[model samples]
Target: MKKIVLIIALLSPLFTYAQNKPNKKKGPTTYDLLIGTYTSGTSKGIAVYRFYAENGRLAYLSQIDGVTNPSYLTLSSNNKFIYAVNETPKGEVSSFSFEPKTGKISFINKQSSEGDDPCYVGVDKAQKNVFVANYSSGTVAVLPVNKDGSLSKAIQTLHDDGAHGPNKDRQEGPHAHMSILSPDEKYLLYNDLGTDKVNVLRYRASNEKPLEPASTPFVSVKPGDGPRHLEFSADKKHAYLITEMGSNVLVFDYDNGKLKQKQTITLLADNFKGQTAGAALHLSPDGRFLYASNRLETNEIIVYAVNQETGELTFVQRQPSMGKNPRDFAIDPTGKFMIVANQNSDTIYVLRIDNATGKLSPTGSRLEIGNPVCLKFAPAQ
Candidate 1:
């Protein structure tokens, strides 16, 4: 009996110590938040904040100025560099070297977009090339990335050759909205809103002029859909597209740079006839749910459950973004929260994501900035 008591006493302290030890999970608790804005309003340039994963919150850390109308941002695969499109009458693409630890960016250089009103920017995984979608000019331009993180003159420029979309007001000319890379980075999806087409371009990172038309060429959406952002599934088996004028989503079965239409889902109610312009679409971190944002009269985010096997999207929930003009929103790496960037409201709302049902609830967390059109996340210590 005494021996048993002694053994229990010895093990009690060890058990208590083990229980009190901190969790050693491999997930990061915080990430660096990079925000791009139109300098015409309250913002002067790009902004950075530390995003807390445990609780949905943001702490301002650093910012850099002098770059005008940084309406969109894309970070390198390594997160060491950032490229932004200067959305101006005279379009330009700017480059910056990023310090993730400090959330600080140093201006590198800039180059003409070879077209007007550059809006979307994308960088290759090898960090060798930068692609910009000149929105007004309806052209896609590619520039080489220098060793020092600067941007060289455009090497290749391709114009969208198609008749204007049906919408005479917004589709008078070709507008390349976004440039999204394939999951394997073998192809580039050029989304032209004015032409209502997603052009597939072969991406050869090692070549001087990398973007050539793919074998499949392009995928045409509804005449007035105004295709905007397109996101690929993590497995590369499916793709989702958001249409601005149509206020709907189109699903595609993706195989080797070829996309076959599968399902089409509308983000609107049966009789709701208010003005709406879809802006951004992104899959959840787990790829189990897809979220699309819209602006104008309907300022809300629509959540849909992704059918894993079929790549079909079923409506899950639709919630107001709690502000106006929710242009871009990002899901955190932990999959616990989503921050909606409302451009006209100058507010970004952090909403709690329901993991089980893919519903979003207000967390009472918000950040106010001027003309925040883009939000991006990167790893931080």
Candidate 2:
């Protein structure tokens, strides 16, 4: 008995040391927020804001100006620059040198989008080229991004052809609503709302050109679906798309660089009647949830739980957006909070997210801006 007791005491400190060595778990870090805009007619400037997320709180760090209707934006891989679309009649794209610490933007240069009413922009993985989707003109344009963070002249612009819908007011012309680069950066996907199709173009970063017929062809949504925005799963094996006019979501089996329609689901109640459209769609960074924004009647965000194995989406919950007309919204870098830009209400609504359940609650911290059109987030620290 004495010998056993002696051995137990000898090994106790070793066991405690092994258990106490700080379990290698990573914690959260400070995140910075970026803001996109649709500045009112009175102000020619769109802006970006930096918010610090620390200790369960956010603080407006700084703001920058001198942009034109920056409705959507994307950051460079190196985090040194930003590219934004000027959603205006003239339709141009602007590049900037982003000072993350100060949230100050220095205009590098602006290049014509080569089409009218450019609404969305994305950068290729190589960081050498930029793609712009012109909504009104129904075209996609590619441009070169200089090493200095300026934009060169547009290299290529391809006009989409076709229009189909019962509503004459909305489908009279092709409207290229959004552009996204593939994971391999070899293809650019442009979804046209007016035609209810998603066009795939072979993108060449080195040549700063998009292959004609775009090579990959296009995917058709259900008649009158009016696909607005889409997001791919982390593995690039599946995609989720939101139809603006139909107010439905579709899942696709993506393989060999092509998208095949798989399932379609509605986010609305069967008996609920409302005149509205869907605007934006995104997959949560963690890949556990998906979110889509609705406009017009309810002006709320619809959440869906994603099945990782099958790529099917299940209706989770609907949360009222604190503002009206949520034209665009973004999940913060940390995925802890969401900020919505209400175009009609001219306010920015912030929501606290429940990670376990994927529900939302209003934070009541509304930032007033004129004709706020979109919200984006950047890094804080």
Candidate 3:
């Protein structure tokens, strides 16, 4: 009887883990998520958390200290290293080696971003280089990765020469908002808010200098659409982009390793329209749904049913973020849940997905932090 009891206890967790896997009938994948936050004003660093998709619960894991304003995080393809954007208007990018066992991060190294206020960072498809978008200076930089997954000094930075829009206050200077890796890793796409164009660059194997634009910077949304971030489809045939200043989503036709605009749709609530409200856009892992967040007038996520063939979007549903000013949010690896970091309310909220309808429901688990800006997840062994 004692042996049987021990055996059952040992197998119980396995059972739970099995249950966390995808249920085809239910249509959602259970995910384990690790999130990093912007600890501004108080700590000026990053915070990590473990989100369990099965129960919609977030477990506080570990943190890295002495780092200032670690705002955006990018995990390597092998999940061995984490690259973060330190929002020091005059700051640098920091790298941390990931310990899968404890979900902890050890500082690896830091390098000048080649410009000031780097708000975004991305690892290339080859995982040999890092790209940063510096907002204040309107520049995009490329840094090489060291052998041990640490960082080498930034070798190149590009200052955007152009400006756009009629509004003097918002369009006064160039603001490079995000740096993203194309699926093939052949090109680096930098979304510039100030210029309303996606700065494109070709990555060369042998780099004397890696900072020049590949072709001309690809023009995205119309002037003042202000594209902020972009995500490619799983098949790499289409791209979905979001505009922060204009509150719109633009679909693009992608082929021959290039992106061309297809359609643009509004991401605002019908009854409430005053100013731009959209912030971030992400596609489901299955590539069947697209989720976008709105901040200014209403704090909620707008869901769209995606047509996989043409990359078009149809309205699905909208769910309140359950917190204020969701500056950024991330979907878990398993695709079962989404965690939103509310910057204004200083809390993180968990939401459960209804797979059939593609809607979100509050999970009632919330963590309070100061200026939670970015979130990511690492695996738990």
* Per-residue lDDT value at 107 in model 1: 93
For every candidate in turn, the CA RMSD to the true structure comes to 2.5, 2.8, 6.6
Question: TM per model?
Answer: 0.94, 0.90, 0.89
TM-score preference between candidates 1 and 3, better one:
1
Off by over 4 Å in 2: 1-28, 41-44, 52-56, 162-166, 214-216
lDDT per residue, candidate 2, 113-218, as tens digits? 9888888898875678888899889988888878798898987888765655556888788899888887777677888888888888776666535555554589
- Cα lDDT tens digits, model 1, 30-100, are 99999999999889999999999999889999999888999999999888999999999999999999999
Q: Which wins on TM-score, candidate 1 or candidate 2? A: 1
Give the residue spans of candidate 1 off by over 4 A.
1-25
Better of 2 and 3 by TM-score: 2
The local lDDT score (0 to 100) that residue 247 gets in candidate 2 is: 90
Tell me the tens digit of each residue's lDDT in model 3 across 1-381: 999999999999999989898776653333335555566655456766666667778766777788878878898877888999888868699998887667778898899998888888998756778989998898888899987888998878787776665557777778899888778776778888888887677767467786556665576568877778899989888888898888889998876446788888888767665755568888876778899998866888899999978989999988888888887888776677888888788888888877766788887888877778888766665
The TM-score obtained by model 2 is 0.90
**What C-alpha lDDT do the candidate models reach, one value each?**
0.92, 0.80, 0.79
A best-first ranking of the candidates according to their lDDT comes to 1, 2, 3
